[model samples]
Target chain A: MELAAERHGDMLLVRVAEPRIDAAIAIQFKEAMRELVADGAPRVVLDLAPVGFLDSSGLGAVVAVRKSIGPDRRLELAALTPAVARVFRLTRMDSIFTIHPATPGPEPTANRQAAPAAEASLPDGADEA
Target chain B: MKPEPVLAKRPAGAPRHPPDDPAAAGRAGAAGRGHGTTALQASRAPALQAPHCPDAGGRVPQTCSGTLRITLPATETGVRRGLAQVFAALRQGVLAGAVARDAAQGQAGAAEPVPQVPQSACDRIELVLAEALNNIVEHAFGPEPPAPATESRGVTAPGLIALDLSAGAAQLHCTIRDAGRPMPDGQAPAGRPQDIDAAADLPEGGFGWFLIRRLTLDLCYVREPGCNRLSFVIPLSAEDPPRPHGL
Candidate 1:
């Protein structure tokens, strides 16, 4: 449930500092994200680098967070750990969100087009995932 | 900021296992009575001998490859812990080594049926397990400690989930028993994926059963009086090259 937010230029980068986002913390996570994204930059990128696992409840929370962010602002996902990516892929939620690899270091205001992430083999230690 | 994970206080008859431990409670020994695996396990040698069960190694001795069982409270944390224990075994403990041995000694054990399974299947198994267990926690047990947790009604104590997984060469045969509310109409719901194209209002829920059905095969659910038993199978991943022993 540890989510750290940083202003990455025009975008806000919120790194999930926890190992998992499951049923146990789904509500809490959604509420926290609601607060964090309420008045941030026009774009919010959830860095799921530290997450080792995410279940259906967590998936729901992510979608709910998107809804709460409203239609005007953008909610993109970045650094999806293998497990997290798999959840999004299997559920086909990947189609909706603009996913990036490693928070897309260079481009913020320059490019709005979220190129599909090379999620097949992210170089994270989640080799196990 | 991570909010403190203190959920509603536990009832008087709360479980004794450490609270909200991702590892400790997940340390639920899932190796339940692997009957008849002792002799084969003994020959496989040293690493299998988990301290808890001397006669049998750290694995479920029921199958030549491996079988695992875990009994835990019907709580989110409990489910998380239970899943952790099984995968820990599958990756680092007896199950991994056994899978390795089965592949390495393929020529010799051609008679026995331990499919050449990939190591990655461990993750899928763990994922499906998390969903199934979480469903029981969120629905069956009804949001962990009930509202009147202080009532201390020994009559309606917290539920317990007993999950048994037998890792066959082809697929994983699983049986989960829980003392909780039965599935509506005593049937496993057909988890159909909703139209994601409706961009206006994205769905938040109903993905649990869909994932469970997607990742698993031949699912069946039965309610026996006071208990609910659900069983299913998950096909193993495409085979991979055999690794050296103790991988």
Candidate 2:
């Protein structure tokens, strides 16, 4: 459950340093994320580049974090490894979040619109706000 | 970061051959004796075996395989260790088969490469195992059942989950047995996750069975008098071209 949080402008980037997010650490992850985003920025970008595996519980934890953040704020995902991306794709969760190819640097606004294919992959009304 | 090693290395001089007794072997073997048996069981009666095909050297490699069986209490810690140990056994079996294949080709002198299981296959297996095992610990055992309650009192002592894994050249077979409540209507759940547009109605659970059904082949669930057995086969990837014999 190694997670690092940093503030980059209005967005808070939380990177999961572990390679796996399974039942073993799913609850811990959700609690950690809740604490990180408790009094932080509205926009969040979860960097999952280092995470090579994510099970259903891990996927559910991510969804739980998003729901905790509320709909007014956005919970975007960035730098999903192929294995992690496949889980999201198979579960159809790719439709729910704005996913980026990598962690966005300084110019966050441009990165949001960088991956249009991801945007196109989202379900209806997911792109709102 | 690379995924943490789920399987540990076997101790030096550990027994290579499976136990002699058929009942012991079936209980400990990767493949179990059952009505709905997989191809591995049909071709190799005892345990998973490397193919006997002769290599370019015209020598058939001796089949080498092993089975591990352990019944653990249906606790979170127990489930975690059970999954890790079984998965590790599966990995070892696959690697051993690959080594045998390489030896048949007379490439034993070449640096023994660290056998690599395909990442996609590994991911699918991990995901399915996690969901299934967690479901058992959480639902089947009813969170934390009181210790020492007699079965006659309708309170079973630390439910037991037994895992059997067998790895063949073309596929890996897994069988999990548990004495827990049967699924609703005595049928395994099916279908995809619910289609949700509103965040309020989004589901946090109920995705376990769906993923298990989708990722596995020949998936079957049967309820015996007092136990539930779930078995599935995961096909190995054929992307890697056959290694040139004696290369």
Candidate 3:
């Protein structure tokens, strides 16, 4: 899995570079987010646009990341794919954080379109884990 | 590492037709179908059972129900997919029922209204299932293929297998069994992302355990006697509860 982090004002956009956020990448996600937080980025926006799925472990990592930051530092999620979003919805985590839409809304980016096109370069089933 | 032979008990009772028909099928379509559709019917595990279990343990004795069994060579891939399919089917039904129950009770304001489960949930579950089954088939059964004739008959010894499903009131309890050299206690896989090292980068080698832990609400592994039983619970949606009365 690949991850890219860029600063946008006070917020940092961390795009999870993977097709699926099942078990194999859940730990890496926690470590990466911890490092990013330690690097002094304040507000964080997880761009889950690339992730097609998130299981319980993935959910735990996101929750852990949220817990890692101080109260002053805000963490938001963006562009949840349908499959991943279903997990959040099922577990009721969707209510905990500020989720942005595909396009930035009055709030941040939480729920996006019904379905987004797969990345042109990523092959189907490439992200098996 | 030679593959082992496995065996499964045939489904119970006389075969019945699919729910699509309560009555018997026309003679033409019924030709080779024995014990009918309800017994020994080929089913994709995830979509069907789960709503019937009343409690945990996945066992509903005294109820006249058909037993669904599977015996595959001890390959991780087959075991993972097979297990996932069974779980997905149960979870799907349970969740759907839950969503419906909430809707009927007009609990729209209650906790996200149990949003309609997207087809993506089903697909994701299927993928995860496949991964788990593969792990059992490949690793649990040792790094060897089963005998040809043994595979032809389906059961293979030293194979990883499981089948314990009982349902009650929006809950399906399942007990998955397998036969393999145990991998130490507390050595189950974790659901964290793997490090992207040279070897970890391989797409196929890892990820089975992660998915298994993620999708299951409760997972328990026990090694005793002759087999390994991995038991878990998949809560069903309460809208369309399994009609235990029918089974």
TM-score between model 2 and native: 0.67
- Global lDDT of each candidate: 0.63, 0.59, 0.47
Looking at model 2, residue B85 earns an lDDT score of 48
- Please give the clash total of every predicted structure, in order: 5, 0, 68
In candidate 3, which residue ranges exceed 4 Å CA deviation? Answer: A103-129, B1-121, B124-175, B179-247
Quick one: ranking by DockQ, best first?
1, 2, 3
**TM-score order of candidates, best first?**
1, 2, 3
lDDT of 3 by residue, B75-175 (tens): 43233333333433333332233334444464555653333332333344344444455555555665574532343222223544545554433344556
Looking only at chain B, model 2 earns a TM-score of 0.58
Q: Which stretches of candidate 2 lie over 4 Å from their true place?
A: A106-129, B1-66, B94-116, B145-158, B238-247
- Pairwise DockQ winner, candidates 1 and 2: 1
Show where candidate 1 strays beyond 4 Å.
A106-129, B1-20, B23-65, B96-106, B109-119, B146-158, B238-247
lDDT of 1 by residue, B1-247 (tens): 2111221222233233454445443233222211212112212322332112212333434443355555566767667666755554443334444444545465674554433344345546767888898888777878544422221211223466666665544567888877789888888888888668887799999998887887787898988667678889876763212322332
TM-score of chain B of each: 0.63, 0.58, 0.48
- In model 2 chain B, which range of ten residues has the least summed lDDT? B33-42
Q: Report lDDT (Cα) of residue B118, candidate 1.
A: 45
**Docking model 3 quality class:** incorrect
**RMSD in Å for model 3:** 14.8
Error of 2 at B230 (Å): 0.7
